[model samples]
Target: MKKSLEKLLNKPLPVDPFMPQRAVITDIEELAPDHKKFSFAFCDESVNDSWNHIPGQFVMLTVPGAGEIPISICSSPTRKGTVELTVRKVGRKTEVLHRLKPGDYVAIRGPYGNGFPVGIMEGHNVLIIAGGLGIAPLRSLIWYILDRRHRFKEVYILYGTRSYEYVLYKEELKRLRERNDLKCLYTLDKFETEEDRRWADRKGLLTELIPMVELEPSETFVAVCGPPVAYRFIGKELLKHGYPESQIFVSLERKMECGIGKCGHCQIGYKFACIDGPVFPLWDTKNLPEMI
Candidate 1:
């Protein structure tokens, strides 16, 4: 491991962190009514081949006239040459992004934030809990684990959205549900119609699934990403199940400007989300009462 780190540190990066590289949209897939996935390829061959990022990290996507926003990299580094972003049209910049088409160019920089620690997670069972769009970032970690399946133990995924229509990655989740190696359970908050009940595995608050996960707390690592409200409840549920704060990891959503830590937009206590984390062990962040 040390030798690999040395080799990586000795290597030269293809693109500077501060300079935005030209990336062209290669494909676009609408995941939901408001959410879409955009795939990009660097116009420069060198960067396209050498750019690497760990799961849970994010990139600063430029929207030209609208400005830049920090977006989680939904694609894993194992998939070379292209990067992907799953975005929802919620604001001005994103609204502009929604209008983008294949062949259009955008400036991109990063692969920032301290991503999840995959090395420490090796040899342990992993429970991935995502609520709403939280799956966007967790999706990267999920694929990385699946690609290198031999390193980890049992894997379980529980995802919850407001309704069946709001669920992202429908086709991909369907494929995962059919796999024998892992478990996939999806739920909806409001299953008013018969069609909703037929599509989802269950219906209720995502926290309800905690008791259903059958893993030894000591041997499992739980990675959670969701709304701030979900974190408060989920943290308590994991504690009740005997998982230490250290064994639980949470991704906090923050407003970020200048993806590097210069702007204080993403400050939590003394830590900067852009630099210190967007991902932090619950033990590390438990003291920051305001953040949760």
Candidate 2:
């Protein structure tokens, strides 16, 4: 009788929520000509262990005078002690971030936004597509997947850049290719000459290379990260190949002020890019404006 009454109530219980904590910059390194990878160590040791995050989630980085910007958490959760972020010097806030040095203090607000559905993606073939600096965010997902290679099926990565010099994770890509667990492809937009080429792989937009790769649209899950133009074309190509809209995910670039939902700068219709998504299912934005 008591068990039946408990089931009938159907009351939801409250649990602890993930909260943001302050962290300080411990180190910074230049990953590319214009991109800097920053590492932050939490001052409080307890926060370091408690602050759990998933791939594709972003943190709101704050500098005193320059305000804040949402940057993807580039390091995998498997990595402990500190978190990493790769930032391209694109605007004022990033320019300020570039000026920050080791030991300098900075404020962090969150590890916000929905991340890649790793559990759901397990046991399936995965395709990761990244263009230019877009590789920064996708790097997190790639690392996490690589760390737990046995859980998933065949994994493929297609990375494209304007030139060989612009490739973000060249060494890492090469190492990953050597691993039997994954397959990797690197492409460039244009090749100056046969002699000038260091990367002898594919050449052209990422969309063109999609058709050349062998993938089962229904069984494979595609994740793309790039500029607005890249997202538009790559997404269209994936759809043309018969991939389901729900299986395709894209990361968007927006001007994010506050990482929390309170700031309206990054709002798109009813969704806040910082809160609702930086990575979203393709079907969610099929008709949304200024999202692609």
Name the candidate that leads on TM-score: 1
lDDT of model 2, residue 265: 88
Cα error, candidate 2, residue 119 (Å): 1.9
> Model 2: runs farther than 4 Å from truth?
1-20, 193-196
| lDDT, residue 230, model 1 | 88
Query: Candidate 2 residues 251-288, lDDT tens each?
Result: 88788776667769888888888777888888877768
Could you tell me every candidate's TM-score relative to the true structure?
A: 0.94, 0.88
Report lDDT (CA) for all predictions: 0.90, 0.79
Worst 10 residues of 2 by lDDT: 11-20
